[model samples]
Target chain A: MKSIRIVSDFNSNQLIRLWKNINNNIKFSNNDFNQVYQEFANYKNRNDITVFWTNAQRVIPSFNDLLEYKDFDENVCYDEVRNYAISLKTYHKEKSNISIVPSWHLPLDFKGIESQNWKFNYGPKFIISKMNMIMSEIFSQDENIYLIDSEIWFNDKIDLDINKLWYTVKVPYSNNIFLNSITTFNSILDGVLGKSKKIIILDLDNTLWGGIIGDDGIDGIKLGGHDYLGEAFLDFQKELKKLKRRGILLAICSKNNEKIAIDTIKNHSEMILKKDDFVTWRINWDDKATNIQSLMNEINLGLDSAVFLDDNPLERDLVKKALNEIEVPDLPLDPTNYSSFLRSLNYFESSTLTKEDFARSKMYKENIKRIESKKPNFSFDRWIKSTESKLKCIKINNSNIERAIQLFNKTNQMNLSTRRLNREEFLEWIKEKNRFVFLYSLKDRFGDLGIIGLVSLEINLKDAMIVDFILSCRAMGRNIENMILSHIRKFLIEKEKDSITAVYKKTSRNSPILDMLKKSDFEEITKYTFKRNNISIYFKSDPNIKFEEINDKN
Target chain B: MTIKQIVYKCLDEINLSLSDGDKLNKSKDELLIGDGGKLDSLALMIFLTDIEKNLKNHLNIDINVLDDKLMSNSNGPYKTIGTFIEYYEKKNEIN
Candidate 1:
């Protein structure tokens, strides 16, 4: 029974009734217009998240006034609304509250727009249009506020009586629109809560292009240029490329000859995505379901985070039957519809993108080389040494804050407590004098992996508590954790600390870190607490690899 | 299917959550709307919209339930199930 409190000007009972069907712990405020602002202002230091929902008409009762006077300068109303929104934004800027500002839906000056005297340059005919712009500005600059396209929901309005309900009862909308609003609200909530699919596992043959490359040959496949089907497929690939840039990992799973498919991906001139574009590919005559599981394990991502796309219904059905947790969308029979279908799915939705997102594919590409180098002739120690791994420990600063926040929030497998912090919360916590935030970036002979590790510590006079410890999966298997632990140990010894306590909070995906403290030589002081004496630093580095610290000059 | 069957099917599709007592037979002159109606305001809206959508999709005819001309007629077709079906049959003939 997790509860959410809502403060709204209009009646949200219909919306609440629909939301209760999905989540039943909704606490709605009384529908008094005067109390909404007070309720929002008084919602400080509360445990439950408070949401402010206001309609365009409720915000400005004189919205109809502008429609009546075609010559009305909207700035008077616009300035009033902007000031109100700014005040509300400042009130909840630091808090974890949410605001849903909807665009205006009333038909204002529609007749004017259609008339011969209409001018396109005149400030948007609808006052809600101005409000939408204001809300967009607030949403883009601020962290928590979200804008709902109230006009679209109103266009989706089916019946007229629901509009009449506004005069009769206080219901803002009818049941149909209310149901849709709940759906949109839930998606926004999911994005804010850091819950989303992480990887997209695509089938190459008919999925990426028009024909099978194994039989059709590389140049014979329909891809790019004026060919309608080929262009459609290319457009889909281009869209997926944009997603990859936004940090959604892309991998290929196809039932073709490994050498032939690899050659095609490497040298195909028409291909928008080349060999290095994919993080990993399983191009063999194996069951796709089994290959998907292998990909999941190789990437260390949950099956729930993988989206499977293929053109053949049989292959799609096979994977769906095998892995029910993976999202397998039904492909349209025509290739032209592929891009629109993918767009409509909205599978990869993230609230925020950090600096680390742009270079994620490059990092995964480096890991591919490391995986390939682990051949039978290459011993584990020999490979580690020959790669020349370097772990550069540095103090966290504004320049690398985004990546540090990303590592803390997204890394699950190698995380200690799995604690998540939003951008503002992370910034506020880092400002505390007693807190020490340590971050590091790794590089090797293969490639330079950007900032991939984070450690947040809350230190007191007697002892230090390790609040957060997380490392990107690309930086694992390199003994970087020991390097971090050793650095912290040196810092504690210099501060005259008595003991260092590290707690292991177990999550479903953090099993790798369950025995992390014990492996680092910290004695188990209690069921969850592990403590270590302030002794000399102890860590082992491979002889062949030289670990170096990067200074500000570098 | 007959008009009566289409009306019954549409009502069933729209009001799937209706209770057993509320699922009474739709006979002629039965109070179906307004103050003494079996359906509430939202239910009545859903019923009319669903009927329009189903008829257009399945039968290829677009009938307006809230037409000003129709509502202002001498006999309002929204009085009961039988009168609505009769009106629909007449409207379809003219179209």
Candidate 2:
């Protein structure tokens, strides 16, 4: 049996399951983590690996107690907990190559909402907060250190605030702890090192196809519709396209006849890729290295982010030799392994794909229209009109619950009402007689974004306070927010309310909302604070965009 | 920060280089410091003060860590890098 060791703050049933899945011979060293800590102070003696399972000094014995320290000052608690985390470093000092996986308390999606006394269900919030404090303790020397990826907290925290207690149980939309957390953890691990390349730079001719485009005259290029080697390039392009849709930038760098290559992507019906799909393109007879350098500058990305894919090893080597940053995965000898090889690529292993990832390719494609109209007299507003902005506000629903939660946790800039809601707290709000939560989705002449913003409100009949208001970063710089608030103000006027008060809480990251409030000339009662909005702000706006009220129980 | 604080930060960074088992049972006397400890010679390649700098100006000390006889004493309290720290601080005090 293969042997492994499990190190965790707590010994639990799920951990045992994970250990069994990994290896039965996995010796779990349970420790009175508290004692294991004191011993670590000496830096000489070693704790027995098998004893960590029973350590009474463990930070928390089980998952249910995630928030015993929640009401305490988060940073102060971290300041204190950081010492214990540093104490744990003694193990890493001696065992530089040991791989230890962490078991977070609750997956990110669970909200602790069973009852007022619900102690154990707080799940990922507490664990993640503490882990965040401890994680920074690591030195640059340890090579065997492993990272855990989990997003359940983000999923649960945001989704919990949406339509509340269906059956009065405060239990959230779901409790998919294992899979959600695993995927979340996977993405964050990718983010820290950023293992996934956000952009995949490709080559034309023999790289994406069987023959050079200059020789084939765009007609003879071998992109398979039904046959053998053309099929190979077809599969390769499909894989590349999938990565593009997931928000990876696709750029072409080839010494090709520009018109012919354009005809290939534009006229070739069998071509899975289109000219409009590429964020940026470099199709010139210049040296491949020069073309790639120009393309990197054009795309505003460092060469390291560009994954140069070419069939010619010499060309790949030339770019790699000249620009040390680019990742050139050596092409296989034959095209047969192309799909399998692409599957093995890990440049853009993100934890979760937000709505923004799905729309990046098209948004970049709009640059083509911009470039086509580069005359001094070309109007920017006229071009924006061609890409009509569409804002669709859908209250948080089952399908979008996961994404909404992700946005809630991840959105930093334009966040109003930044107070994170526990499952129980959210349940309390939703079940209360006077609260409502909803999310907003915006698209333009570009595409249909399913959902992109969140706004929650609480009502006491005579007064209303906004609880949560945040927008995705991709949707920033657009007036999609003003459009949504217009809807809210109208809703309040219909209810005969005197005024609609909005709260803008202060956080280090939510400064953008402050900026918006200032730009709109809203009444700032105090720093990082706001008062109610009168209906005139939305009703008196220009009629360039359509404003429609959407009311449906999600 | 004082020399004792500098010494503590340096030792903490070095102790951080070890395994969990060694870390949990780490003794004040087992800490390796300068050229006198069990850390591979490369650990000395990093100026001991460089390691202390990461502790956020929490410590400052001037000590030659690359000396050959840092931890060679068989009977003295400072036999390894870990023990050397214990002996040097035996005479110094920090509150």
Find the 10 residues in a row with the least total lDDT in model 2 chain A: A48-57
Worst 10 residues of 1 chain A by lDDT: A369-378
Once fitted onto the true fold, the runs of candidate 2 whose alpha carbons sit more than 4 angstroms away are A1-195, A217-219, A365-554, B1-95
Q: What TM-score would chain A of each candidate receive against the reference chain A?
A: 0.60, 0.37
Q: State every prediction's TM-score relative to the real structure.
A: 0.58, 0.34
Name the lDDT value of residue A32 in candidate 1. 51
How is the predicted docking of candidate 2 categorized under the CAPRI scheme? incorrect
* lDDT tens digits by residue: candidate 2, A343-454: 7665676645678888977766665332221122233343334446666667655676677666666665567866666555655667876777777776565356667788
In candidate 2, position A344 carries an lDDT of 62
Candidate 2: residue B32 Cα off by (Å): 23
DockQ of 1: 0.04
**Backbone steric clashes in candidate 1, count:** 0
Q: Give model 1's TM-score versus the native structure.
A: 0.58
* Number of the top DockQ candidate: 1
Give lDDT: candidate 2, residue B2: 50
Best by lDDT: 1
A339-426: candidate 1 lDDT, tens digit per residue: 8888766567666788888888878666643222211222445545555777778777668878887887777667889888988999
